[model samples]
Target: MKKLLVIYWTFFKMGAVCFGGGYAMLPILERELVKKRGWTTKENLIDYYAIGQCTPGVIAVNTSTFVGNEIGGIFGGIMGTLGFITPSIIIITLIAALLSNFAHIDMVQRAFGGIRICVCALMFMAVAKLWKSAVKDMLGTVIFIMVAGCSVFLDISPVIYVILAATVGIIADKIKSTSKE
Candidate 1:
């Protein structure tokens, strides 16, 4: 019970200030789960983030659910999900109720514009960290470049990139092993 509460509170706090999206929440999740409490490692958190991205739900909530499940169990997944979404639910509800009335205000538009800029900055920071950690070798660098270039230039789905990268990695590993042998 105590563990569940801690998981919920940690994720709740993380979700409260998390803006921009799941990637933007990475640093906060790292600080709370990996640095502050030692509940997970950076790599594991990254894995969770990856899985969350591929999953069928919001990435932040999905990552929180994975962390909570890692910390506790099914109940933890439930609590973590609930805690993470709680803020969004409340904020969206309030905003929905109030935003229409003020949607025409220039000040409101400016504030939202500023918020979007801040979110972009936050996402860039997260992406930088991920790049540093994930792109460790020449193969990783190649994959990174190819994926980024293709994603930007091509109309292909992300799943195709993931699959191609995975295949490339597996073949690269096999070649390396065979050469060493």
Candidate 2:
């Protein structure tokens, strides 16, 4: 029970401040779950983030559920998901109620503009961290460049890239194993 509560509280705090979606949450996840809590490793968190992106629903919520389940089973997953979404629910409701009144205010618009800038900074940090962790080998660098280029210049589904990447990784691993024998 205590463990579950702690998980819920931890995710709740994450949810409250995780602006600009899942990428923006990466630093916080690294700090709280990987560095501070000792609950999971940075690699595992990145795996969770990747899987979360592929799965249905919000990435942060999905990642939290995966971590929570790892910590305390199914119930923990439920608690973590609830905790992560509760803040958004409350905040959205309040904003819906009050946004119309303040939407026209110059100060509110400027605040939003500032928040967008901050979110961009957060996302850049997250990308740098991901690059350091993920782009280690030549193969990884090649894949990164190809995907980045395609994503920038083409109008293709991201799912295709993910599928191709996974397929390439599996085939590369198999070939590498065969060459060693």
Candidate 3:
């Protein structure tokens, strides 16, 4: 019961402040869940983020579900997702009521612009952290370069990139195993 409440409260705080979605939530999650709460480690959260990306929902929500499930069970998953989305529901509702009146305010526009910049900074920080752990070898570097190039230069789905990377990793592992044998 206490653990479940903690899960809800922690995720509620994260969801409330995690402005730009999954990538933006990484640093907060690392600090709140990993460092403070001891709910998960950096690598585990990254793995959850990866899985969330490839799954069929919003990445932040998916991650919340995964972490919650890990902490408790189905009920935890429910609680986590509820905690994460509750803020959005309330804030969006309030914003929807108030935004029409404030949409033309220069101050509001400037605030939004500042928010966009902050979100970008948060995402960049996340990418840097992820890069340190994800790009550990020659194969990883090659995959990262190829994916980064394609993502920048092409209009392909990221799913394609993930599939290609997974296939490459599998083939490479098989080759190494055969050589060892």
Best by TM-score: 2
RMSD of each: 5.3, 5.4, 5.4
Model 3 C-alpha lDDT per residue in residues 14-49, reported as the tens digit of each score: 998998785767898899988998887889999999
Query: What are the lDDT figures for the candidates, one per model?
Result: 0.86, 0.91, 0.90
Alpha carbon deviation, residue 11, candidate 3 (Å):
6.3
- Arranged by lDDT, best first: 2, 3, 1
Q: How much does candidate 1 score in TM-score?
A: 0.60
Candidate 2 lDDT, tens digit per residue, 1-181? 9999999999999889998675768999899988999999999999999999778787888899999999999999999899888999999999888998898899999999999999999889888877887789999999999999999999999999988999999999999999999
Determine which window of 10 residues in candidate 2 has minimal summed lDDT: 16-25
Residue pairs clashing, model 3: none
Mind giving the per-residue lDDT tens digits that candidate 1 earns over 1-181? Answer: 8988887887788778998674667888898889999988999999999988777778887887888888888999989988888888899999998999998899999999999999999789888877876889888988889898989999999988878888998999899999999
lDDT, candidate 3, at 76: 92
Off by over 4 Å in 1: 1-72, 114-120
RMSD of 1: 5.3
Q: How high is each candidate's TM-score?
A: 0.60, 0.62, 0.60
Backbone clashes in model 1, listed as residue pairs? none
Candidate 1 backbone overlaps, count: 0
